[model samples]
Target chain A: MNDHDVIDNLAESDDCLFCSDHIEEAALGILEAEDQERFEHHLSGCSICRAELARLDTAVQLLPFAVNQIEPDAALKLRLHERFLQERDAEPTRIPSPRKSESRIRGRKAPSRPMWTFGSVFAGFCVALAVIGLWNLLPSNESSTSMSGRNFQVYAMQSSDDQSGGHIGADPDSKDGTMMAWNLDPSEKHEIWCVDHEDNRWKVDDLVVADSGSAMQTVTFPKEISTYKQIYVMRNDGTQELSVAPNQAINGDEPAPSESTPAGD
Target chain B: MQSLAEGHPEAMDLLYDRYHRPVFSFALRMMGDRDQAEELLQEVYLRAWRRASRFTDARGSLISWLLSITHNMAIDEIRKQQRRPQKQQAEDQTELMISLRADGISMDTHAILTERRELVRKAMDQLPQPQREVLELAYFNGLTQREISELLDTPLGTIKTRMRLALRKMQESVELQSLEAT
Candidate 1:
């Protein structure tokens, strides 16, 4: 045999722990002398390997400590057990009925529209017009809160055409005085503008035209503003305008009763 | 152990009772939170319940299987928290040294070895950082060398070497302490 063959044979001891492949094939115990010797040698010289082995040994030792009899809250356990039994008993009888399944399938095929859709769409358009018209017509309101300890009322404009007058006061409780208005004409472009109640300044945030039927845009006030008084929706074409005051008419074109009157709950 | 495949609640309860504490404790030590340990324990049991039919007696004892589960769950939870365990404080190191010296011997013997434990602790403290980490991970975290490699982002061979070195140093420290006591 060649010198390389002899050296390979000498290193390939049956008892060598480092030769895990041999150990696995032989089904030898971990504590075999070959394994122990290799481990001892490695332990003294190899810090990284020694640390890993130590961690493994610690984990093995700690396994017993991890086992604990976990008694969940007795009441909770009992309740869950009772529920399980009840569900187990009821499961068979509650199988889906044939008629119910048929109805479910039919329902999925043809969904119905609610009556409010048409009215809301029309109202949405009117509100959009009122918002824009009122924007140029009304002077912006400047109402600041007092530094004293009393809470003050905040307002914004909300215009909708569903009601005959097509105008309503903005929701006072809306923490942010933001509102939305839409244009009814699908082909016409619409603009949404916000009026800062505190600063009495108006800024156009968005302008978009409706593609098919109706257009809608939401306008939000800056976070710095504590309250708002009005929102206006105007046509980019400048044909019609719509607005909602904090508690007044939808558009400044008409004098309407202050919508801010609170109702007794 | 009863056959877990029979859907017997009693068998499940027995299995849970047998393995819950060790698993919980291991998880607690690994995670350092009672709530997380409890949660992990429950998840381990629930998984065991679901996969009970797959278990076989030929591979190893039920304890080893449960331990494997606990180790995986605890490691996962620890990873999720993204926490690295700080090195033990000097006082804790001293305390551990005392415990190692006492070796669960008699109370009187423990009292005597307490001072010597401080020396052992110092010796352990002198070990290289990697060796110390491997020793702690092995003894306290119960991670296999493979798991340790993944957790520490080191190769398995490297972990094994570190463990061997740590233990050898510990053995040396122990022998020296014995000589001093003599």
Candidate 2:
């Protein structure tokens, strides 16, 4: 019988011991096709077996635990990744420009053929992606209006736990830099860290995103910017809100430092 | 889990890293051959990526959901490759209860898994040999109760009873362990 054709609580529901005996097998996916269909048809009509099956389902879920688990070969991971790229067509998504009125604080020209794009197309992510591309292309930190050269390396922040955002223009030759940031939760105290390869952290400055969800700050680091491996924007509690490896503009695949790292966890 | 449906690659990558071991382990156990298990693992993740939006957290945890997909695909792959349900006895029934140590999991999680495995091992030990053989034949080797009944030269009704008893005994054993711990 079709499931819809099976009436609920059939007059025979109470006497479904025969079908109820099969609930565990059915839950384990071991019933033959015809037996499975018959069991399901009966299950639709029999409330008793349905309840038994509910309990049996939990028991059956435990069956995998009965087997000793073996770790698959590590190379299988790379093979699986290749399959994902092939199966999904993994085409990099193009970012559409924000409308003229939707534009925010400053007019930074978006770059063509940006290397990395976030799977999310939220306006904030797009802005960060664009600047990451543009910053890498620019010869120096200079407005087209002035054409003055500051020779800064762009460090664009990638958002992690929250929707917090930031883009920094740092002089690769020195410790001085300018930061344009947005979408930060204002209540938390935000700190910046410049970390070196030896796992050293320098508490350079506090990047305060105002109540308006954006901030601009001219920063002077305690150490030369070139010496650090990554610059992190984090909460005072050391929970990393966003992280960026130095020179984010060169490539989009640069790994950001860890995020939302609780002290003991 | 909702993060996966957000179409965020980072979220999917994060989840894949967390659960791949269990998923690969389950597929490896089911497929019984390393190459086949690896292929099945690739297909399972590919399916998960494509169908993340259809998965609802209210139904089950992501690991169980991933395993269900793995089981379904493995079964189909077995049939497609013309492999029938296992026709022989398990080489080592003890192997079924072998060590399960998943690296990178928290100690508490590892302990829970360890305890669960211990309870099941103890439960299997408690079962009559006939009942343990029947359960093993059906579960690890993918034999249906009918197939097991025929393989063991037992009546179908008897096989059903043994299977039900075995599962009930396992649940009882787990609950008993939990109660004793308290």
Candidate with best lDDT: 2
lDDT of 2 by residue, A89-208 (tens): 442222222222135313754333221221222344346435544654567543332222334456667766334566666545445566666655454567777776666566677786
Question: What is the TM-score (0 to 1) of candidate 2?
Answer: 0.52
Question: What's the distance in Å from true for residue A115, model 1?
Answer: 41
> Model 1: runs farther than 4 Å from truth?
A1-265, B1-3, B85-133, B138-160, B166-182
Q: Which stretches in model 2 have alpha-carbon errors above 4 Å?
A: A1-11, A14-18, A90-265, B84-109
Clashes (N, CA, C under 3 Å) per candidate:
58, 0
DockQ of each two-chain model:
0.06, 0.20
Could you tell me the fnat of model 2?
0.43
How good is the docking of model 2, by CAPRI class? incorrect
How well is each residue in A1-265 modelled by candidate 1, as lDDT tens digits?
7322332454433423353322211111123334434444333334444444443343232223322223232243244334434433432211111223355435453222211333455467456545544542444342222111112222223223221112222323322232323223333345554444443434445444333223344444443223345555654322224555544432233322233422211
